[model samples]
Target: MTTKITWLGHSAFQVETAGKTILLDPFFTGNPAATVSADSVAADAILITHGHGDHIGDTVDIAKRTGALVVANFEIVTWLQGQGLENVHAMHIGGSHAFDFGTVKLTIAHHGSALPDNSYGGNPAGIILKTADGNIYFAGDTALFSDMQLIGDEDLEVAVLPIGDNFTMGPDDSVKATNFLSPRIVIPQHYNTWPLINQDTAAWETNINLQTSATPVVLQVGEHFDLS
Candidate 1:
């Protein structure tokens, strides 16, 4: 079975695999290239890395409309429940949970997770998705850390990382991350939405190719790639 990966701009993505559909950080509403509106996106499950507005964008509306199970840290889950989203599974870092589609392991990430209301948002985490085809690592808004070598030991097929700087790793550090993670393919995200995080993705891809063995995949907003 092949897993289809689609980039919906910013940090949002759709992963289709094993007869299930999963959405990650659905921030499509205000995005210029967002093809589907918040109320129209559907998924069997949704994984949130943190509680930032850009990452949790439209999650409340999307969860209400699709009835997808929301997965994230304990605090975020509790917050979502407080917002009337009942179907949520709260898992802490280093915990793994089995779902209908696959197993999701919460990995470490260096970022803040406070909600806009100034409430404790929960521990930020990256998601490691183990599917039938291969392992996918979504490094949700992080800085370059040495532990990525341990993640690389898992033999990941694809790694979705942020190269947007300011909020996450910049292009140079992302290149280092690619070398440490050593995934077969690397997809850059969390850039170009606003001026604060704007980046030249094409140049970043070239720099990564030169600095690491991993192949860099640059996806336009709403573009999909099939990974078998």
Candidate 2:
């Protein structure tokens, strides 16, 4: 099966592979960058990277409506259960789980995990997906770290990173991250959602071409690319 990844704006992504539709950080409710509505998207599974409002956008509504399995850290899982969600699976950093769709391994993410209500969200995480088509790494809101070289050891087909400066790493650091992750394709996100986090993706793509070996693919909101 082919793996298709769609940028749902910001750090949100829709991954379709192995007959499953998985959503990562599906924040569409108030996202200015989102072209689709939270009411329209379909999912078999939802993965949350942190408890940030943006990252947790519309997850409850979407998951409840679609009966999709929700994967997240313990704290976020507890929070979801508190909000009356029953189809949640909790995992933490360094933990890996196999699902009907693929295998997901959570890696360390240097960021906060406070929920929308300021509840403890648990440790933030980056996700590594091993699928039939290829491997993928989704580096949720994070700063550049050296351990990404170890992540690169997975032979990633693509790496999705945040490039917004105020909340996450800016473009320059994202370029450096690509150098570490060394994926065949690198995609940028978590930027241009608002004026505070706005960035010029074109310039960042140029820098990625010059400084890194990965091909930079800057997808527009609602655009998608195939893997394998």
Candidate 3:
């Protein structure tokens, strides 16, 4: 089996695997670094990592347009339901749910969760995808935490981590995180979207390469990585 992962800028990603199209943190409309528009995105399911405006970008509109199921925490699910959205799967940290293509486990993350409208967004989380081809870890907006070692048990094939500071883990902490998850390949996200979080990806890559065995795959806005 083969899986294709595309970076959509600012932590957003398009994962095509197991005959399903999955979108992670589909922020785009107002994303300064986004390469595609909200109208151009289509997916079988949408997975939201948190309730921040940047992470939940265009989720309601896109779900309404494509009828794609929205997967999120209970609080965020209820918020979306109030918006007249019916297709949603409410999940929580440490819980795993089975989908048509694979399993999605909501993992722990250190961050805030508040909807754009000031409603409760539940707890922030990272996503662990157990797919046919490999396991993928998408670390949403978060600071470095110790439990990441648990994710290593899955034998992570790829780990998509936020390298932007101020709001999330910067290069130093992110490198330490790699020591925990130990994925075969690591991809940097959530950087360069804003000046406050802007980073030198090349420096990050070099640091990781020197310190860890995992290869850092730095991608552009629309770049992709194909794995088996």
Question: TM-scores across all candidates?
Answer: 0.97, 0.98, 0.98
Question: What TM value does model 1 have?
Answer: 0.97
Off by over 4 Å in 1: none
lDDT of 3 by residue, 99-149 (tens): 997899999999999999988898999999889889999999999999888
Model 3: residue 30 alpha-carbon error in angstroms: 1.0
Q: Is candidate 1 or candidate 3 better by lDDT?
A: 3
RMSD of each: 1.1, 0.8, 0.7
Candidate achieving higher TM-score, 1 or 2? 2
What is the C-alpha local distance difference test score of each model? 0.91, 0.94, 0.93
- Write candidate 2's Cα lDDT for 22-57 as tens digits: 999999998888999988999999999999999999
Off by over 4 Å in 2: none
Which candidate would rank higher by lDDT, 1 or 2? 2
